[model samples]
Target: MAQKSFTASVNAFRDKTKAQMRDVFSEAVQDVIETAQQPKARGGRMPVDTGNLRNSLASGLNGSFGAPSAGGYIVTLSQLEIGDIAQFAWTAPYARRMELGFFGTDSLGRTYEQPGNHFVGAAAAQWPQFVAKWAARVK
Candidate 1:
């Protein structure tokens, strides 16, 4: 048998995982926004774990051979102003969940700490992707 290159497979796994994660967070955020925008609703804050995604092959072999994709994006309200949350609070329940906590200041003199009711014990590796997706726009 010809030699196999597992490097490509490994990289593919990582890239796919990252992309999927980005998409998941983007969608979750969108839902939060949508929910908050609805009329006659109290916008609650986003939960630590938003919710669970349906079993799908595209997500992974999770249905039968892979792990189930965890739903929800752990986020903070640092970039969002109170008005923004209020505007979306009508539909999205989590808009009200936003909190202002203090951890420490960064080089830019910004407060960087865990917001209220965020997913705790998240893998460190997922941080960059989560933040990137949270900041990016989703159609």
Candidate 2:
């Protein structure tokens, strides 16, 4: 009687796939950032200037497949400044209100309308397509 044993290694395949996926994800994130940075039309009734808001926009990616336990890659888009002032002036607080027109007027007495800056919302809307493109790259 003869006994035969075979060993198959998948480490190389896994590593290569992981690297490719990372690259694809990085590129997709950059695209999202660029889209978010584009100047959005003034949707507010107050006609506020958007130059500063566009300039303050930024994006970043955190975590990786290198450490799955730490959670997968996360792409974040945000304003550069920190604290309540920044948050109210440019970040989510006032931005969301402006975009959604939740309030009639801001502290500065600027009137709002439905659908504001749409910065984050626009980027999020493109997320599905971005993921699909990244997946296609990996495939």
TM-score of each: 0.30, 0.53
- Tell me how many clashing residue pairs each candidate has: 12, 1
Please give the distance, in angstroms, between residue 32's alpha carbon in candidate 1 and its true position after superposition. Answer: 0.3
**Candidate 2, residues 34-100: lDDT per residue as tens digits?**
5655544533232246444433333223321122211112323221222212111133335555445
Local distance difference test scores for all models: 0.37, 0.47
> Candidate 1's residue-wise lDDT over 1-139, tens digit each?
2235577777888877766555655455544433322222233333423342111101111122222222211232122322233111112233222333346785678766656532222222354655566556532
Q: Candidate 1: misplaced stretches above 4 Å?
A: 1-4, 41-139
Clashes (candidate 2): 1
Q: Could you give me the TM-score of model 1 versus the true structure?
A: 0.30
After superposition of all CA atoms, the RMSD between model 2 and the true structure is 10.2
Worst 10 residues of 1 by lDDT: 53-62
